[model samples]
Structures are given as structure tokens and as C-alpha cells.
Target: MSLKITFSLTASLAVLLSCAAKKNQQAEADCPPKPCTMEFRTVGVVFTDSKGDTLQVKDFSVTLKATGKKLPSGAEQSTDAANPFYMIASDGDKSALSVEGDTVVVSGTHPSSGQVKKTDFVISGGRCECHINKVSGPEKIVF
Candidate 1:
């Protein structure tokens, strides 16, 4: 009698799992295809002094405000004086985002003054979204 009960429970569990798998498949099928561009998508910030001269912000980093998680920086370490662009986030970094998303702080230091400046950004994008966006904050910051 005990053996029969165990077998019945196992069969019922299998059936439930099968139904769930089918439901998941249907949900995936219902989702529309998200077309993405081949170009590498990235959010960058250009910093400048009050005089409108490009200021090189060194050691740029991103931090999630909610969890205090530090996102990786993809900025190159080259000393190209002409390019002071700071990377905020790239498409590949979408795995770190949650469905509801979170606010992030992009901080960096001025090369000459050593003054640290921070900018707040609301980033929301997942792997399905195709690209990350800077919901707020200026494209060019004058420090």
C-alpha cells in the first residue's frame, strides 16, 4: 500500500512538471522577437571644466545605490588626452540589472584637482531589452 502511494505521488509530480514546462514554452513563444543592432552599445559621459575644456576623469566607477554593488568599468586605461570619455555601462553589462532596475552613481576624480564628482543615473535594461539607457543625467558634465 505504501509503495503504491509513493508511485502515485511521483506520477502526479511528473505530470505537474510537464504542464509547467509546456506553460513556460508557450510564454516564450508569445514573446515578440527583439531586434538588436550589431553596433556595440555603451553609455558614456564626457566631462569638462567650467571653461568647457575637456577634463580627464580618472578611475571612473559605477555603484548600485540599493545594494551598494559596484559595477565593472570598461574604460580604457590609455593616456589619450583627446579622449576623456568615461564608460557608464555597456550592453554586455545587462546581466547585473534587475527587472525593476536600480539607480547607479558614476563617480570619478579630476586629474589635476583630484576633486571627486558623482553623477546619478537610472539604468534599466535586460538581456531582452537589447540596449542599456541612461534614463537621467547629462551627456556632458561641467565640473
Candidate 2:
């Protein structure tokens, strides 16, 4: 009788320990102890015509390449076609751009544009310094 009780107790203890170990292992796998940090920046230029006339771009797009990642966005502006200059602005820490008066400024760090890393977070601005000319018709201008 003593031998049977001892064996049963040992077996029960082993089963309980195995279950506890499994639960702990599953919890560890479910939650990662360390999180990754990602950062980026956006850089580009604006285009204008020769007669100081701002060209109206129907659909403007920008692409940033880094870490095999591509980020794209569009711009909106007045449809007068005479003063049809559009400005792009960043929305959050992820990245964005905006227009201030005659200058177009880009904010945030793009992975491919400059020497930025995931560890170092930064925000910057660049001007699309272009000479303007008379707007005659529809055209594509790059800054």
C-alpha cells in the first residue's frame, strides 16, 4: 500500500509540474520582451514655371524608399489653375509635409532619403526652391 501511494503521489506531482511549465512557456512565447523601434524621413522638391506662375498639378505623388519599404501620399490645393499650387504636409510622427507661403517644407525622416536610423528620431524641412514662369497649360513640374 505504501509503495502504491508513493508512486501515485509522484505521478501527480509530475503532471502538475509539467502543466505549470507549459503554461509559463506559452506566456513567454505569446509576449515578446523587447519591442522594435522604426523611424523615417521625407524629402522632395517643388516645381514651378518660368513666368513666376505656379503650375497646377492635378495629381501629385511622392515615394520614399528604405528598408525595402515604400511610402506614398498625395497633395491638395486650390483649383484656380492660376494660383494652383498644392502643399503636402506630414500628419504625425510617421511622416508628413506642408506648404508655408512660397516654400514647400517636408517633415519627418525617410529611411531612404537621408542618413537616418530607427534608433535616432528626427524631423527636418527642405525648400522646393524653383523659379516661376507663366502658366499656359497643363504640365508636369518636379522640384
Instruction: Specify the highest-lDDT model's number.
Output: 1
Q: How accurate locally, in lDDT, is each candidate?
A: 0.76, 0.37
> How far off is residue 57 in model 2, in Å?
2.4
How much is the lDDT of residue 20 in candidate 1?
95
Identify the runs in model 2 with alpha carbons over 4 angstroms from their true place: 1-46, 67-73, 93-143
Question: Per-candidate TM vs. native?
Answer: 0.68, 0.28
Deviation of model 1 at 50, angstroms: 0.5
Q: Which ten residues in a row have the lowest lDDT in candidate 1?
A: 71-80
How does residue 28 of candidate 1 score in lDDT?
51
The positional error of residue 135 in candidate 2, measured at the CA in angstroms, is 29
Superposition error at 99 for model 2 (Å): 20
Which RMSD does model 1 reach against the true structure?
Answer: 10.9
Q: What digit string (tens of lDDT, one per residue) describes model 2 on residues 78-109?
A: 45665554433232212222222222222222
